[model samples]
Target: MLKDKMKEVMQYNSILNQPNAQGRYKNYKCFHCKQMGHIAKFYPMDYKKEVSDMKKDTKVQGFKASKSTELITYPKIIHFSTTCMIKDTDLTNWDKIWYISDQINRHVCYKLDNFYNIKEGFSVTKLKNQKKFLFTYELGEVLIEESGKSIMILGMYYAPEVTLNILSLDLLEKQGFETKYDGNRCTLSLIFKDKEVHTFDEDRMKKMHNKYLQDYFESLSK
Candidate 1:
């Protein structure tokens, strides 16, 4: 009886170790190329070709002059009065903390001073009047604690040229948050998550924008 029981256990272990009819131990799909049998981490990426293709596509689109005189609707801004602390260090001198709904920006951007020990080697080119400049920067992440709640800002670019940090509308939407603009005020709420967050009224929003504009013009003069 003991010999028969041992033989059955060995047979079960052998069957469990054997591959399925398709003959694959495990199936893996590449997230980037979307091909099977391999993962994204080990896949050889062609960065140069990707960047070249992107530039070519942009050039193909070209530029078209707008002929319409109709006024375009701009997104309302939300202002925060709380201080932005980076890793237990209070940024007392840095006061401008506001978010404007911008559909064009793909990533969240912050001033270089807001982060600590950023990892470098990334650059972006911005074109103005056919002139392009290399905007080099490092990437950093920060925890924004506001109104008794905290949100982690991932993949934030440390841009030195920008006067104020901007939270991208695309990023917010991608994170399952929705924004509703009612001309004078904007509300940001999460779709599936229930949490209390900070918001600004119309009057305070206007004040924040005015203060930023004043500081911007003053900086230009100097």
Candidate 2:
């Protein structure tokens, strides 16, 4: 029974993977630049271009259109998700009918709720503080144990790319690990538990996992 239920849940993609349901939600616009097709980061100049440009441009491929995408000012390649609810009849029907009452009784379907993904990169077990890797496409969480401290993180919240790389470099430096980042690719060499560690890094994958680790470290620093 449990396996069957799990199989049923695995059928749908996470909200990030699903097509944006064309209801009332529109494309994202930059509040700073008043541009359409992108959020604030998409526009560089006004918000101290340094901070904006410092950001690595990670683009998500194959996203369907929304209201904000239709606007002329927004960048076409950038993606944005709506936060505030719009007062649309159709949207109202969805919220009132499906999300509220129906969802409680019947199987509810929403982008965020459909899938589970524990972290951005490939899940691993018994690495550093990580004890296990559990993932479902839509939502993901991580379990950490160190110095008798154990934590289970639940949700998509994670680190930015730059922060992750910086943190990873910092850790590697401490352990006398050698690493190189050629713009997009990052290589790390380390010695772990008397074993010579050698890794040919995937910049994209490293960034993905780094974001999570960086975010975790930042929270601790804070």
Top model number, lDDT? 1
Q: Candidate 2 versus the native: TM-score?
A: 0.15
Which digits, one per residue and each the tens of the lDDT, describe model 2 over residues 23-45? 22237654754534444443434
Estimate the overall C-alpha local distance difference test score of candidate 2: 0.33
The models' CA-based lDDT, in order, is 0.51, 0.33
Worst 10 residues of 1 by lDDT: 80-89
Instruction: Give all candidate RMSDs, comma-separated.
Output: 19.8, 26.6
Model 2, stretches more than 4 Å misplaced? 1-168, 181-184, 192-222
TM-score of each: 0.38, 0.15
Once fitted onto the true fold, the runs of candidate 1 whose alpha carbons sit more than 4 angstroms away are 1-96, 108-110, 128-134, 180-189, 195-222
